[model samples]
Target: MTKLNCPFCYNTIRRRSELHFMCRGRPTGARPACQPELDQVRSNLTGFKEATLPTFEAVSENLMLPFTKAHCPKCGGETTTRACSHCHTRLPMEFGLDASPMVAMVGARGTGKTVYLTVLSNELQKPKIRSEFAATVRPIGEGQDGFGAQDQWVRESIHQVYEDRKLFSTTAQAVDGRKAPIVLEWRGRHNRRFVLRKFRTNYLSFYDTAGEDLTADDVTFKLHYLRAADYLILLLDPFQLPEVQRLLRLPPAALLHVREGKPPIDVLARVTEALKQGDHWNGRHITVPVAVAFAKMDAFNQHLPETHPLRARRRTLGGYDEKTGRIIHEEMKSLLHEWGGDEIDAHLSGHYRSYQYFAVSALGAEPDYENYLVNPRGVRPDRVEEPLLWLMHKGGLVPRAAS
Candidate 1:
């Protein structure tokens, strides 16, 4: 049996042994273990009180037993759904039975993670792209038939970016205890030996938190989700790099908007430390594939020559091209050195067993700021889907061509 990670709380559930049940009545008004501390933090960050959260009780049951149902101990109501043994969040129907890839997005504040996620979801759901991979992207559980609150947020974020051509507001730093993860189910045919034979379904869980929450040194408990990720996407904002900011020669007004938090290297260090505290390697390098991407590539194009590898575009709907990806990786490495990010490069190399450099531009052009909205020319994403496709290829979800 596979040990599944909870998409909501980032808890690992050992399917064979531990099974947790939640009240079907959806009991409310009870507080979680860390509610008081979390509430204080949320209030300080967003200046608002979090709503009361539901309480979930753990149920110990033997799967080998013949019991067909469970009942909540407190409310005595019939419990029909399973939850994460650790966080008590509801689990999807196929949570333990199928392969689920937990992809975590990490970066300093103002790194465009929200935009990347919005575009990545849009690209994955495109019919042509889905046809190329023989995959269909759908919501799971509460989001299966209709949009849950989190699903609605994702849909609205995507619509605002793609249809309305407006930039999403920076994700708030406060943590909402009631927030559920946006879980997507990917069903596709696995092509093997030039034939589509096995049908595979994977649950893709995305956790998008405010960048400040990730870099908070005083609060590490809330960021435990980083350790449970199967893959990590470290988005390095070019604009955040001090050297790049100087080189870009932006106007003073643009510089004023740039809020520099912890450096990318520092953020990566904290993530690696979190992994060490968990079951992730002890005194060993992390084996999970880490895709360190340079986001907002369009802003840096002026510095690169016309023949730069980053300027080369590939078909977004086709299978991943390792040759092209490698070229971009090398080019990005060189650019990182030029941008005085050698420490970031060195830290990744020393801590991760498998790492790749990528450059992606979610918006093809810079946005025109109008009040709180940023209107771009059009949604012409450059290589926004490559990092995800690369992760899928590395995980063996898609067949890799012979080297």
Candidate 2:
């Protein structure tokens, strides 16, 4: 009886005894769109005209009865798929029956969020990792004829980072020009039980926007999808830490060259304001788990002691080590304080009731720029999946154990 959230519109669908259906094909005539909200979503994803939108009609007349399929009332054509009752968008095969976790990745510019996402996707698709987790992750709406803009962007991004070993360009800053959010479907069974009960599917949607868009004053209205996220991963760039920049002798030119957008504190404040507006935190701590991770840790790995928890690499994947996660969390918090990021630490602690810290390096080593291309030594990610694994464990989707 779990509640399902529409990946496109972020509308919550309550559990019901009977199933509902919506037409999959576009309306033949000018019957008028039944769901204007869904039409807006379609228009945002694709440049389709609202007047030529598909219409939805409920197939079942009784709430306690089951309907295998239905016909579009407008065209009299049969439909074999199901859709969200609130929004007419087609639902995944068994969407309403399983759990779907919406994850949002947010950070200031040059925080390595895009690189982290690219590497994380590659890591999740690895044979050994998928075998250990007993899951298969793939992008949604990829094969569909109508919706392909967002899917194409994801494919290009992954190919660039994993195949070509090159970095992606800066995210588009204009709200209207930005691509749609990347949505993925993770289908697998639980690792705890041996006997087969029923296979479960979880939909994971990611929203990656330009760092400038997040810092804008009108972000609350622009990025309304943040309100529907089940988990938040806030990436903090090591180069932005004033103490780290000074200790490493990183020149002003280097900082300016990388387009260091805004301080992490300011970006986080803007995110907090948006969350408050959504009633996520009403003068109280928010329930959504936040992972405050230090991206580009490879650049600063030399500064840490040999015995530092972050220096160790994770080997197994069936379950997370709670004790080890806590150790790293505390170590990262201490490092932030020493790096003159105590204000950022304080802000997170005050607003989020449940939060943890992590350190990750997407490239495993700093890339050398030559002839306008980077990563001459090739790319090897180090512990890039740790944050995702931690979130899965916290949500009880994966097991947790002490090291």
Candidate 3:
């Protein structure tokens, strides 16, 4: 009996023995068709107010019994689509029964969370990344072959950034305005114990939010997912750092796109405060593994030499490279102190039991600010895959040695 958290609702899911199912819809061998109706619970949690397949709960008298399958009461057909008992949001059974780690993506506005996430998902599915891990990636949501809201939302976001050359505009506050999460199953012959299991399939969920959503006391309960996360990917925009600001000679148009906000330390402190309020980490130090990444490293290219680890173009990482990971981690740490962000590193050291720093650029080159488009050289993603990969390594989904 694995205890899992609903990535969408942040509610504890009693898996295997207690099961919830949603109708697949339509008639089935004498079974009635399920009509789409308003699922208020899901709507309240996800802001997905549109009518959806109804979900119902079932529990076995025998606690040890594996209650894997259920029939829709409205329809007599066997339904395999499982949903959260609390919010009625459909979730993959792979995660429900297997207990998977959840990673929350956090960053202030202008950190390019949307852009980085888009590129990361794209890179994971590309041949370069897929072949290295011997992995298969599939988005898990309504419909088949990556259909439904999750796939469509990611598709559109990817198209906008990679094809249209325009970055995602500032995210709007509220559940409805945020980007739908990138949820999927990462099945592969990877993981540290691959020699034993031979293969492992992991269901991963990446959740992001508008910068405005963090640090507010009012949102403490509304954003409970942060506390429930097993791992976190914290992104920091170098442009926001005062030291970077004083040094960079960015164009006025580029500066216009930057969101005015507090230093990264304030963001980290507020998140720490919120985690303290949670039941799990009510202490000074938190146990969640965090990948603290400095996004948009391209903005500082002129300041760095070719030998800088951040500028090294990666061809393919057949697997997680611990040596390279360590080099970049230390480089970012030293750079933080140089940029007056040692406080950010200090806060993590004092408050986090485990964390790693990284330097990444979603777009390998700075976008043409005056033209309001991606770099003319196009969207050359650089090291956008490291943060999530590190979290995956911690989750035991991928091996530590690069092949």
Candidate 4:
């Protein structure tokens, strides 16, 4: 019988012999001999034999056993595993580079993260940016053809910028479709190069999960990627300021649950909960800095509350600016310090020991869909350079340029 224990709860997955699975193994239960105590459970069952092992050759087929339903300890909901919507599977570890600086993105839906990624990847292809940054861009794990499929869908969904440029494409739509893993290699001007290989490339890993999946109680993907990140770029929508205030106060009116949208705090809570539940996260203190980018700042800066003096520092609400960047960073840190993120920061400080902040706008101007034509041209991406610059500096991938 396949008897595998729940890594999070450490409870033997109560299963009967009639269950269709073979025994994976049980926890030792003495004391976690390692920092990530939960990961101590054995995952490699290479030679273990079973009386009735299913003959399916693929790992995906093997996961569908009768007693394999993972339960969320919090709400007891069937734990949902995180996977690429395009590929319907956990991204292959081979797609990751061993020495690349690992950066991760976190944000609410429609905060322009996907679009930003499309633009950033496309921009990296440019010689000015690529050469200036001393970085080479390529798909690490997923091959060109595999990633090509995903990009095709993305290019087709939104209008294109270059009629012949083909825009950006990804390979996530196959049943076993490959997810194109993008790797960025930063070669500093000083001829020193850093190939951040942990997640397998000097590039950032963009994580996009459906909002519904993130909110569920039994999230199986929790803690898996937390340790993979060296920095986190968290996007925010400035238009949701009112909702943020309500969440902070826990007012009864806010409890009514606005139908049109969800609050950031809820998402933040889910993320933190996932981090706390992970069995493998090294807990080395996330040396990564978190940028709470108030995306679409252009659309909502004038609406800031009078009590929030930070509004006066705005330099064109929706546009990106370096001066405004410094202000938002300070304000965000202050807000986090007040909201108990300081404790999290203190924990990370012990590990990463160094970090910084920035604000950015991927699109400089709004799309003119006057004709309903896709690929509306004239994409003026502003300060799209800031975040990468920050990551490179912090990762020690670059040296201070001589004056």
Output the number of the TM-score-best candidate: 3
Worst 10 residues of 1 by lDDT: 31-40
lDDT of 3 at 312: 74
> What lDDT would each prediction earn against the true structure?
0.69, 0.71, 0.74, 0.41
State, as a TM-score between 0 and 1, how close model 4 is to the true structure.
0.51
| Cα-based TM-score, every candidate | 0.79, 0.86, 0.90, 0.51
RMSD of each: 6.0, 4.1, 3.1, 15.5
Clashing pairs in model 2, backbone N/Cα/C closer than 3 A: none
lDDT per residue for candidate 3 within 22-63, as digits (tens), equals 777857778668888888887777666667888887744346
Q: Give lDDT: candidate 2, residue 207.
A: 73
Which of 2 and 3 is ahead in lDDT? 3
Q: Candidate 2 on 1-403: residue-level lDDT in tens?
A: 5556776556677763233455555454656424333366455543333332254555464557565566677555556566655545556666765678878889988677888887777677778667876788777766873346556777887788767777766777645523456677777785546636567777777777678787677754567668878889988887887798888776454466245488889889988888877757757988788888898788876777666667864535466777777888988899889999999889998899989999888888776423223466777788777787788788877777545
Superposed by TM-score, candidate 3 places the C-alpha of residue 204 at a distance from the truth, in angstroms, of 1.6
Worst 10 residues of 4 by lDDT: 48-57
Q: Compose the digit string of candidate 4's lDDT tens values, residues 1-403.
A: 3222221112232332211221122233543211111111111221111121111112232455843334323222332232222112222222222224455555555455655665666665567665554555533333432234444544443346434323232222211111232333343233334734332234344443334344454652443444345556666544345544443443342223233446666665566556545432346533345555555333333344744535445443211344555666777567555444554345434443344444455554443323322234555555455566556555555443432
Tens digits of per-residue lDDT, candidate 1, 283-389, equal 67887788888988888778787777689545333567787888889989988898888998899888888899989988776665444344345877878878877
Off by over 4 Å in 4: 1-98, 138-147, 150-204, 220-223, 243-259, 279-287, 300-328, 331-357, 367-377, 401-403
Off by over 4 Å in 1: 16-82, 86-88, 142-147, 174-179, 190-198, 252-260, 313-318, 369-376, 401-403
Clashes of each: 0, 0, 0, 36
